[model samples]
Target: MPPSPSTRSQAAAPPRRDRGDACPGALRLHQAADGHLARIRLPAGDLTVRQATALADAADLLGDGHLSLTSRGNAELRGLAEDCGARLATLLRDAGLLPSERHERIRNILASPLAGLDRHTPSDVRRWARELDALLCASESATALSGRFLFVLDDGRGDVAALGGDVSLLAESAGDGAGPAGSALLRVGDDPAALRIAGPDAPRAALTAAEAFLTAAAASGSGAWRVRELPDGHGLTARDVAGALRSAGIEAAYVAEPPAPATRTSPPYADSAAPGIVEGPDGDRALSVLAPLGRLTVAQWRLLTAIADADGSGALRLTPWRGIVLPGLPAATAPDRLAELSAAGLITDPASPWHRLGACTGRPGCAKSRTDVRADATAAVATGTTVPAEAPTGSPPSGVPVSPVGVPVSPAGVPVYWSGCERRCGHPHGTWVDVLATAEGYRVALVDPDTAPTAAPAPARTAAPPAP
Candidate 1:
């Protein structure tokens, strides 16, 4: 079984702060192993067609022309030149991408990628997301939060909640008008559901809750940034959070264990059989596009923008899984547009090569990686050795079948990930087979499905003879 929320919350050891977190941003780039890395924050993972194209252009102009999607629903440009940081910042700013330099890193918010469309969801979570973002940017103290600090506004589903955010506001039924017209359960970590606030006030309540955590961190003087890192006795409590909300003139009621909600995964984009039937106001139909291995080229980015302009609504939604959802497109034009994307090697089918596969910025992008893992994995796939379903089952004990080079493919479509080293930065969220690169070649194992394992040990690639 997956670890209880409390157990998961306690897993992170108190972070030892040597200095402030220097996580790269569009304005502040990081000198990565491959080159300079710039991370552009996408609040609520909303991207305009033009903005998406701009990111692709930035990648091609300043970096290696490859874009990487982060777990936080942001984008990363690797292999950037040290000198291009300023120019890149200017380009992003002109595109209305970087609104605040001070609040850039603190804009970590993940909401239901399909909140507005899902019948079960409340009104668009985007509104609350935008409001919370504006509030966070305006607060001077929010700068103190670490770049990794996260906030999730789930549409009552446990999807984003499963990500283990620092602050989470889950929408819930208003309980027959007991409190207000629309209210949600406010929770922290795996703790008992602590409060209930008006649905409209959820954003403010979330911010207040964050402030309470910051206040506790300040009192602890541990220099801790995340809520989980607070010492046992110094942790923030529901009562204290309620007090803080009251002080801010927000009504909040304490509740016990709150009900866990369901979360939505990336809907399959390959199903474009009836496109124009579900049309949007602009006479465009929804087009779901996937980025193979979650990486896209500048040319491909431009092509997507053109497709969206010609065939879809002007807006784009970037899923946490690194896929794009173009809503409001004309149903008649969707099939052809999807074919264009597929011809360009984008994953348009659920059974395509990109489905369960993910890779980090290996080779030239990350200095810590021992091998160009992505290249090697691609080669393995091209040779027809790595079958999509061959990924192993529950954490295969050490010395299990390694790669497509020798292992027989399984019938079930299990997930697999290729990691440069043990860090395994971009491993898939749920059940997956782990293939880690070693001095020898690649170590393979079936990871335990119930518990989300961080990284599994891979045998040295040198252990086995090279495949002929």
Candidate 2:
């Protein structure tokens, strides 16, 4: 759980950094404890099969023979040679993955992964994601945005609405005005208020909201790197952003204190631990596949692309959930293709113990990690000590053996995140079960929805110690 609005305002803040964020990009690699690391941002996580193949090639040739899917729908390559940046960049550019070097770091966009594919969603927010990305890249003011700045386009689904976006456009339901086609609600940061705009104006309004943040950040002169980083009294709001939109010649209507939808839900097929096949907007069916531990070996990558090209659309959409969606599949061929995926060791069953589990780069990859969390998590799963068959997605499974220190162990089934340490990098937003590593063992905690996002008492289980 994260801090509430009031709690955030009153909590102590970390010291301001003297330098800009050093987040890695395709061109600018970061020297991690493991090796050189590069992050490739994929707007709305769209990738052609050919592009994915190229990435696979690059991973084998320049990286550690694997790809890591990030929480923001980006792809990461780790354990690269010091001189691999040039070759990596060339391969990515040839594949159309690197569209703009200057704006690459700023193209942080998260769209509803199932927007057009699911019938519950009214619009294909991915289109708006493209428009917004192009606009942001074209605007000079956007260059001032930090690499951490994020834009979200949730297609009326709650899947990504709570993702802590700096600027967000949530699709409106029919009858919410604008028109029968509905409109979009623009919200800046965590403000309860929002701005209503026609669907057509959504992209521009989102950009304007970002620009407004830049303006306020400059006015405050605190060098705020994010919306929440501004001085307490100078924080931004929906009204200020709406005014900014008006100044930019976009009509904006302020919806002061909008009500949360009574029954907001995640995208359809999101819960299944098995092969998830959904109908696309074009009347074609698509297969949603999960990559265990958010990773794919180069061989797995090539296999996925091959499947997409042969049996489904020639495209792939990488989701923030660490899943890959191969849309545009012919309905008749779905079962066969899905079998191929499952045979290749990819997760295809919703009830699978492997589904919805995550681990950080522990052991040799990260110096800060107390243990090899990945290996420990794997052992926990292999020994039937983790994720059971009956738990719902995102909930903690119970009934594992207690730690040697006499702590009670929860059963494993629900979505659980394993972090090398307490930072909990790459953990999903909202409620989740957490497994944090400690020198003594692993402490499992359920994030209490009632409490202000703190680790509540659960059980402690000893992860198998690293082999000598």
The candidate maximizing lDDT is 2
- Runs in model 2 lying further than 4 Å from the true structure: 1-11, 175-180, 261-275, 281-283, 386-414, 456-468
lDDT of 1 by residue, 36-135 (tens): 8888889888888878878877887889988877766778888899999888988898888878889898798988765654344554567889899989
Error of 1 at 195 (Å): 2.5
Tens digits of per-residue lDDT, candidate 2, 1-468, equal: 124665455444523535566667888787777788888888888899879988898889888999999878889888899998889989999998877788888898988887767666754588899999899879988988877788988887566777778888888777444433657888888787888888888998898889889888888777776787777677899888877888888887788766453223433313321247787666788888888888889988888898889877698888887888888788888888888888888887776677767787887887778998787777666655334456454334445433333222323334567888766677755556678888877766666443555564221111211100
lDDT of 2 at 298: 90
TM-score of model 2 vs. true structure: 0.88
Report backbone clashes per prediction. Answer: 22, 17
Candidate 1 worst ten-residue window by lDDT: 459-468
Residue 331 lDDT, candidate 2, scale 0-100: 81
Model 1's alpha-carbon lDDT is: 0.68
Report how far off residue 317 is in candidate 2 (Å).
0.5
